[model samples]
Target: MMSRLRITEIFYSLQGEARSVGWPTVFIRLTGCPLRCSYCDTTYAFQGGEWLSLDEILRQVASYDCRHVCVTGGEPLAQKACAELLTKLCDAGYAVSLETSGALDISVADTRVSRVMDLKTPSSGEVSKNDYTNIEHLQEQDQVKFVIADRADYDWSCAQVSEHDLTSRCEVLYSPVQGKLAPRQLADWILADHLPVRMQVQMHKLLWGDKPGH
Candidate 1:
């Protein structure tokens, strides 16, 4: 049998987070993840999904008629076919982006696809799973995100930013863990440190209050 991806949800919505925030985008949220971040919001995606071939996924995305596409997950890279899916999306002329947990080898993903890698902070409970080597693959079109749950995460993120000279490689984003770290507190911390990174709040969470598949 030909293998297909196990997808938890596929929906059309505005990009709620990341550098492309506010753009009309189609989201393909695959099922399963290796790490469990402390503040993970998509626990629903950990199991149970429909199997879909790459062609079928592309067809569904194309039906939206939008050029921007985000391939996200419960860690999309956990599925062996994800890299192929990304390449196919790029070949089909969509401005594709991959939202990964920074725990997988991203070198094989299509060069045209923008990679938004989430580097787990100490507070996330999955920091040890981070594949630091992925930092080498980041280009200016890519981004690294740190979801801060407390001052420790903020400090660790700041150190990583300077240690990697991440500002020179790609855009860096700092987001507060919803309900754990207040948005204003995280913003204040960033401002106090004068860190050269973008501070973001999940627009979907702000607008729709973390409704599933938003």
Candidate 2:
């Protein structure tokens, strides 16, 4: 396992996505991702980043005095040290959560940390990268998110939810891609079908308007 991780940025922000939305949280955004999703906003994290040891990262997170810590990335699991970081954060008594692209093996993540895994839709252009096996590992505290861009994406996401009985396993979230799909339309569809999923928008975006490092 790596003792150090290439980090893009670490800052204090409200949890933007997932079940913990709006909670004050420390965000550790790691650098590098293997897939290129078209709607990707943090493309800056694809390349350069600073390296930090696990202890250094922990210290930085603790300095924020935040009880919730979210480990995110251009795919944080791309780095081997991420697994170690999550375990250490949990050991320190912080409520830890991981936001992964769902293309990597989440089986290595610390059990104490809640996982928010994404199932890439066809519009993301990285759909083929979705690792279906990760679904089996999702615990009750874990969640699945689908960033839907249009009707087609929403339909496909609904199918996956049924095929996997996603809600029965954990929380399932359906979020519309800003600008591509209207939030109201997505919400209507969800209500129309009675899909067992939570629909949310990026709260930070509403407050910060695409500001970097919020």
TM-score of each: 0.97, 0.98
Per-residue lDDT over 104-144 for candidate 1, one digit per residue giving the tens place of the 0 to 100 score: 99887899999999999999899999999999999989999
**Using alpha carbons, what is the TM-score of model 1?**
0.97
* Cα lDDT for residue 193, candidate 2: 95
Clashing pairs in 1: none
- Segments in model 2 whose C-alpha atoms lie over 4 Å from true places: none
lDDT of 2 by residue, 1-214 (tens): 4499999999998988898999999999999999899899899989999999999999999899999999998999999889999999999999999999889999999999899999999999999999999999999999999999999999999999999899999999999998899999999999999877899999999999888897
Clashes of 2: 0
Looking at model 2, the pairs that clash are none
Best by TM-score: 2
Candidate No. with top lDDT = 2
- Give the local distance difference test score of model 2: 0.94
In candidate 1, position 48 carries an lDDT of: 97
